[model samples]
Target: MTSPLSVIILAAGKGTRMQSAKPKVLQTLAGKSLLAHVLDTCNQLTVDETIIVHGFGGDQVKSEITNQYTQSSFTWVAQTEQLGTGHAVKVTLSDLPKSGKSLILYGDVPLVSCQTLAALKAANTDGMSMLTLTVDNPFGLGRIKRDQNGNIEAIVEQKDASADEQNIREINSGIYCVDNALLHKYLPELSNNNAQQEYYLTDIVKMAVADGITIVAIEPEHTFEIEGVNNRQQLASLERTWQRKVVADLQEAGVQFADPTRVDIRGSLSAGQDVFIDVNVVFEGDCTLGDNVYIEAGCVIKNAQIGNACYIKPYCVIDRADIGAGVDIGPFAHLRPDTVLSDNSKVGNFVEIKKSTIGQGSKVNHLSYIGDATVGTGVNVGAGVITCNYDGVNKSQTIIGDNAFIGSNASLVAPVTIGDTATIAAGSVITKDVDSSALAFGRARQVQKNDFQRPTKK
Candidate 1:
């Protein structure tokens, strides 16, 4: 509830271990780029100002973010060189005001909680508050050097630590909440005096301690919250960690998971009570599930909302779709953009619905493509039925009234309609609208051939 804070995320690493053409920060975990996760976390913290310091693939990173978050209040900072972590922050932090403190994070470590960050902000005072934790082996990490009273004195890197310091468990997590005014005052004085010729942010702790400024070291709520992703293996490990954590959270919220490990939720997923999610479900973008919704395994839903009691079967891809209550979708269905199904409607296996609106209790079952159509209630669309929505020139629509029955192998060429209770016979191609209770069969009647003669072979 304090004033919105500033945030700077370092995302400059090339991530050579990933062996990928794309930058590490641009690698996707749970369907979003790694840096997007960090930016989203910052937004969740109500950070007034956020900056992304990009080094490797900086242009692509900036373009992707700009395309995705057109209205977000964030500044993109470019770091041309692959400098140390301290130099990465220093170069891009110019956009921030010199007066307010900031919460710094790494783009590769995206699962940090805002609650922990808020606690760090609460501990931020005259100097800085670092997100610290004790590990079993702090050999390569900078040890947290404290005074007799247990106050953080200085941080010593692995090579700089003495024999006694090697046994110390508490270490720097590389995440901090520092006083911006003080940081700005001493930033220019930072020198590349280390063996690697890289500036050290840890030096600020010594400066603050010598000047009698307070430095607080708060432990992270979860140890994995600060874990960094260096390769595909690590990225995948963290992705699973984040997904499993979300599954656990949802399980606590009364969501029944068929197989927790197989589900992947990329963006925000809000579920009502009694929602059931099956295995291998990848939910991207934003999705909302109403009460009693049953999602079967291998369902990929995105930018879609499922109504109460809707059953989404296996291998269903619902994107940019909206389903009403009691709807049943697919064992193999693709509900594309602008598709909407009313209550009690059914789209069975091998069915694809695009830019169509199916009315209540309608059925489009098996081997069908219903695009650019408006179907009324109680419509029975048999197997292998298709609405020929696309002509050589432009797309068209097929309108069917209530209780209309379209038989198997029927192709209803659009800009066409069928009146209420009209029946189209099997293998019919409907090119014009039919009247109520009429039987429309556009195909020619059967003609028998007799006495067929065989021709001589060439």
Candidate 2:
């Protein structure tokens, strides 16, 4: 029978360098909290259960994490005094079954992948295994002290190491895979006789060494994958690292980007063939761009589904809108929820479409507002047009039939409609419907009075 695997994540530290009241693990990296990334990878390891150790800002971290993943069955272990890493793990071990393997991780180091963890698990023995990395400069990190034959050795802290021990390039990465029973049996015996008076989990290797237990060390391919964050600089560095990875993934999946570094995708994006996304674009909450779509710079799209051959010009704010193929939306267009544009539609600059449907081959050009309106095919709605679909109390609808020509500066007050092939004169206020193939002129006639002149005072 295969032994079950459980992951223990140490995330209780309050990062003072971060300069925030939030816990260290709660700091966002790559649009997700550090602990969230750790737990996501842990799930891929087939981990039966996840146990988190919380200390500083324990209540805030617990409350936020619990709220974020309400359905997850994770155990919380509280070490009230920030005793140390060893004591943190000890607080959570009482809940474990004491038979399977326990993999220890740090939440601030959020980039660990499932492949690396699987490799470490495959290399684990009956004793204990440590994830080790060799660097050019092993300055402040703890050194891995090996034996004469180099079979097995102990992990020595930086402060406790002698001058000779400090020269070792191989450093322990603070991650381990160990048998649960052996780990629990030896963890309680760890002492705090050091200068800091804190229990170090690294000392467990020495205890295992004294008992003639074999220890294996595995190095991760990328050293940055294990770099833990204690400050803002490290957090920013890792943020760039993760963002590059995201960009690479999307590019590989055939998404064309004008500038890879300038795009930010906070949620899932589905792009069809020949979709062009310009710089400074942000897409969130499951956006889909169909084939031959062109999206300009400074666009923020959320929860939208755009169809093929559409042109979304610069600085457009789109959310919860569904668009059909061959649509053109503007340099400054705002598409609010439930707005649907059918094929061959044109919504030009400074136009706002909300809760409306624009039919095929319809054009609503510059400086127009269409709300709660249904516009038909082959319709031309000119500049400075307003639907006037609101009476300051409730919104109403204005429906237009096919081939209608609405002139410039026209105000179509709802609830009203214009029949097929109807024409409205420019600068008209249309309050009533016009019959098919007719003209409707609602503007009063302009009359110039010759005697209408201002008199000068005597």
Identify the leading candidate in terms of TM-score. Answer: 1
Report the C-alpha displacement of residue 441, candidate 2, in angstroms. Answer: 7.1
lDDT for each candidate structure? 0.88, 0.88
- lDDT digits (tens) for residues 1-458 of candidate 1: 36547898988889999998898888998889988888877777767788888888888888888898988966888888865777887886568787778888998988788888889988987668998889998778989999999888998888878899989999898899987876786667777887768888888888889889889888877888988899888888888888888899899999999888889999889899999988889999999999999999898899998899998889999999999999999998999999999999999999999999999999999999999999999999999999999998999989999999999999999999899999999999989889989998978889988997889799
TM-scores, all candidates, are 0.95, 0.83
TM-score of 1: 0.95
lDDT (10s digit) by residue, model 2, range 71-127: 788888888877788888888878877889989999898988888899888788756
Q: Residue 258 error for model 1, in Å?
A: 2.4
C-alpha RMSD by candidate, in order: 2.0, 3.7
Clashes of each: 0, 0
Worst 10 residues of 1 by lDDT: 1-10
